[model samples]
Target chain A: MTRAEAFSEREVAMCTVARMVENGRTYWAAGGGTPLYSILLGKKLYAPEAQYVTEDGVIAPEPMLPYEPMMTMLAARASYRALAWGTMNTAGIYSQLGYMDYGVLNTLQVDRHGNINSTFLGEWGAGGRRMHGPGGADTIAACCWRTILITDQSKRKFIEKVDFISSPGYLDGSEGARERAGLPRNTGPWRVVTPWAMYDYQDRRLRLMARVPWVTVDEILAECEYKPLLAPEIQVLEPPTEEEVQLLRTELDVRGQTTDAAGGWIVWDGEKYIRGGGD
Target chain B: MTTVSEPATIEVLASGTAPYHKIDPDGFREWVRDNKQRALVPKLMTEKEAVQKFVADGDYITYECNYLTRGPNSLLHEIMRQQKKNLWIAGKFTYVDVGMLVGAGCAGKVDTGFFLCTPSVRQALDAGKLEVYEYSNVIMTMRLEAGAQGIPFIPVRSFGGTDGFNHSGAKLITDPYTGQPTVIIPALNPDVAIIHVQQADKFGNARIFGTGISDVPAALASRKVIVSAEEIIDTEEIRSNPGLTKIPYWCVDAVVEAPFAGYPGTVPGYYASDPAVVMEVFASVLRGAVEPYLEKWVFGVNSHQEMLEKNVGVAKLLDMRKRETIRGGLRA
Candidate 1:
């Protein structure tokens, strides 16, 4: 089997997201599964100086190995040796003050305008399925210099218009829409990553920047309800190197907690991935 | 994206017109001055007594920190057990505990920023039994801070562009300094705020070792504060480490010495949350078996200790503490 064939969709997504973490930058560490994995992987692989502040108030948290998602916090019996400890106020102030260079957030849907909706699915106030509401995502997206959104791509997710703007992207894709909407100038959705493809907001519109080698641009576009703005040169996303994959599998997520599946646990079944153990 | 001229006098792009839970800052200040007893007496009480005395029916209540970590699950369970009616909640970054409360008909109005769509919560929302006033997690905490500061409102960099702003009691106002638009959220002074901490004294000088998310603000902002501690140490210990005290005795109304108060959650230096137990509860709720789950966990049990002894057992608690000790490297 080919090297690419061995990797799961979740692994690929994480690796792709890890590459976006710029060195010597501060990031709002995500608390969710894949996004959290991506942040840690990025910190470990390349951005060693990329200080992270958690919503739980741990500043510069150096989490221990065999990472248990929630256990990495101050509450975890394992001491993280965090640089400084404060309340959510400290994190909120830091982000609003432009200390955060990058913010990594997960979302359920992303519209053409880059507005994300993690709160509700379907119509609002009409019995929409409520999801995990914007914990710190609102402040992160609004205040961070740039934000990277990680979500699974589907027609329902990559849609024409999000049901609700949990985190404002480019409000209406209009020029200075974000600023007009009272969001800080020169800060908004920077990049969007998925298992299949990568997107960047060029002219405040979702533009296909790169894709995995297996999936065609047309195939990716077919999955999105609204056709994204195509970049002049679509790049083939590099597959996760053997070293990166091994590090992630062994050191970061040994128990396959984050890489198992997006929402549910899964294991590779040689031909196709299948749910394992059961949710 | 192009740079455009700013709107004149800050037009609110998005806002929610939900009635503020308590907006009279002056009244609040007066009440704090007149009603609050600034004494160093033993404020210790049982969870049942604390919840009953402080958490009144139709009162706007809040739990500090995320329900997953450092959340007052035991106190919340007490409220649910008491079956407090029509309570409004400031569910900040909460999911399970809040869902359980709503499921049990303890709370009807929830001003939540981060709550998961469980079957019961969803059913409540769908059936129009629950009223949700959305706000972001940061905004919710900030609102508490505003109340603590005795401010009528607080300004934030974000909120005008999001749906939460529309569903929350947040408004856009002109920043007099920058002559730009700003999102200002109303101050939230909850009737009662319950916090679970790592340690506290008999006088309610609570010290939270890890991530004091919004506990301080919640404690200071609320009319009545209930602090449940994993270990209640001597007042001398608190006096020796005064800086460690996040919530002082003056702010707290009742201090409940409840060990493993954040069961299914974490208490920082004490123990780690059992996610499997939390997941099992979640799964059970999803399966529409909330009644059985509540009966077994909350209603059936008299106290947190009883629940731990009868259902969770000593072995599980020991195992969790061991895991936490290893994870936190408490000994190391």
Candidate 2:
């Protein structure tokens, strides 16, 4: 546990799925990404009575549904949502955020990730979108510190290396994505961490910063569907630190959760794990 | 104060226990008719003929969860399949934290465009024909609460200035003081609100004892509304449990009965949330092409009844649910 102990196969998948909700990262998947994206965007994600005010001062629903014309360089509806994933906030906005449609991409653009989130390409109309990471200029920005856990919807929670990756944010590469919008140099390339491996953009090519704890360098190399990278060091990525564990127990565990009849609450009383009994 | 002997002999005459409360179908039907004329004239009604009467090209429609069944096909799926702008979902993220949303939605529609909250619903969308639109529930709520509370804006630190959504929209903006591009997701107004519950009166008064809060905002946001329930209880019964009601009768427009509803679905007071079926649906999508799924969930299942009635479909779905429970490692 001290120096990069091998992660149990179980831990790998847990990390992948759990890390998917970490702070300050824009995630793109196939269909459902609104909740994760909203979390990354720092919204108050609640359910049932999410509130929103209209431009006219009338209260609206959760999952803001903004006009497409007003979207930023990234295709944003600028709508707030409080539901879990793909929820509508009280503000009358529906993020309409979905995972990427690889099929749509293959049919529309030559470069799959190019303008992957763009609505102008085809039948996507205005609701189409893609996310760009904080640029290279923001590299080393505390914002760059992030993790994206990728476990399948599988029951076993298989934690394989990233199946694919063209770049940190969009397929155009962070810099190219920024430039497409006339954005400045992106230092946020440092914002590269995935379940299978960690990536750092050094000179246009991605460098494997580290592998998930316990996973072999070779395992990472083969699992990824992206352009391969050689390890800068034979080192593995740091596993969940004791400090993080403590933080997970004390600070993060009780953020927005509850208990039910089948299971109890997940409460951290500064010492041990409290399983479901609603006590 | 009667005499002791008199009370002993006749107290039984004063016994105040009412025996049974059978539904007055004829009277209830009359009340429903009146409600239909007044509340449901232009508004959508739950009557099969009425619902079928006003079909629209309007992409979004609301449905109650009670009438909705699981297995990737349900009433919501029917509504979703009707939409042309690609289906975007906004609701509770995980059914139970085992994974994500897989109830009535997963088995209902196929090959249709699906959008999800980036992190929460990402799994369901990925395994299907979906596109990801990353938006924050936190920021959106802050804004909605701000709006609901009548504030111009609410300052927050959730996922601030992250890429793809930095200064993203009317809801998200930059704080001049901090220069941090904050997300300002505006409150949403949905096209329709579909909600489910355990009981409702001839009037729209509904009684539920679980988490039905999310439907409120969604219903308030939408232009149209639908309420599905397990039992059309008496108005007195619904009124008796007014405190337990999530959506009041006035807030509701139409009520339809869908018993044993929330199949492969959850309506809180009605049933427990299940994730095993959800994982299997996702796994099934992973196993095959979305085309067959589209055909089966969309073309194959026409209504919630059909989805739940199909033995093969329900069997496959239930198997997945069972397996997911087993894999969850809940046994300790």
**Predicted candidate 1 versus true structure: per-residue lDDT over A165-204, tens digit per residue:** 8888888889988777777899988899987799998888
How much lDDT does candidate 1 score? 0.79
Model 2 lDDT at residue A257: 20
Candidate 2, B128-231: lDDT as tens digits: 54433333333333333443343344543332223323223333344444443433334433334556655666666665432222455444444344666667
**Residue by residue across B1-332, what tens digits does model 1's lDDT show?**
98666544654545677777869988888888987778888988899999888988999988877556777889988898999999998877765767788789887898877776677887887788888888888888899999989989999887778887888898876676677777899999998888888788998888777666688889889998889988889999988868777788888889899888888876666676887876677777666777888998899999988999998888889877777753342321
Instruction: Report, for every candidate in turn, its global Cα lDDT versus the true structure.
Output: 0.79, 0.33
Off by over 4 Å in 1: A1-5, A69-74, A77-79, A254-257, A262-279, B1-15, B326-332
For candidate 1, give the lDDT of residue B57: 91
Interface RMSD of 1: 2.1
What shift in Å separates residue A46 of candidate 2 from its native position after superposition?
A: 29
Kindly give the stretch of ten consecutive residues in candidate 2 chain A with the minimal lDDT sum: A99-108
What TM-score does candidate 1 get on C-alpha atoms? Answer: 0.92
Best by DockQ: 1
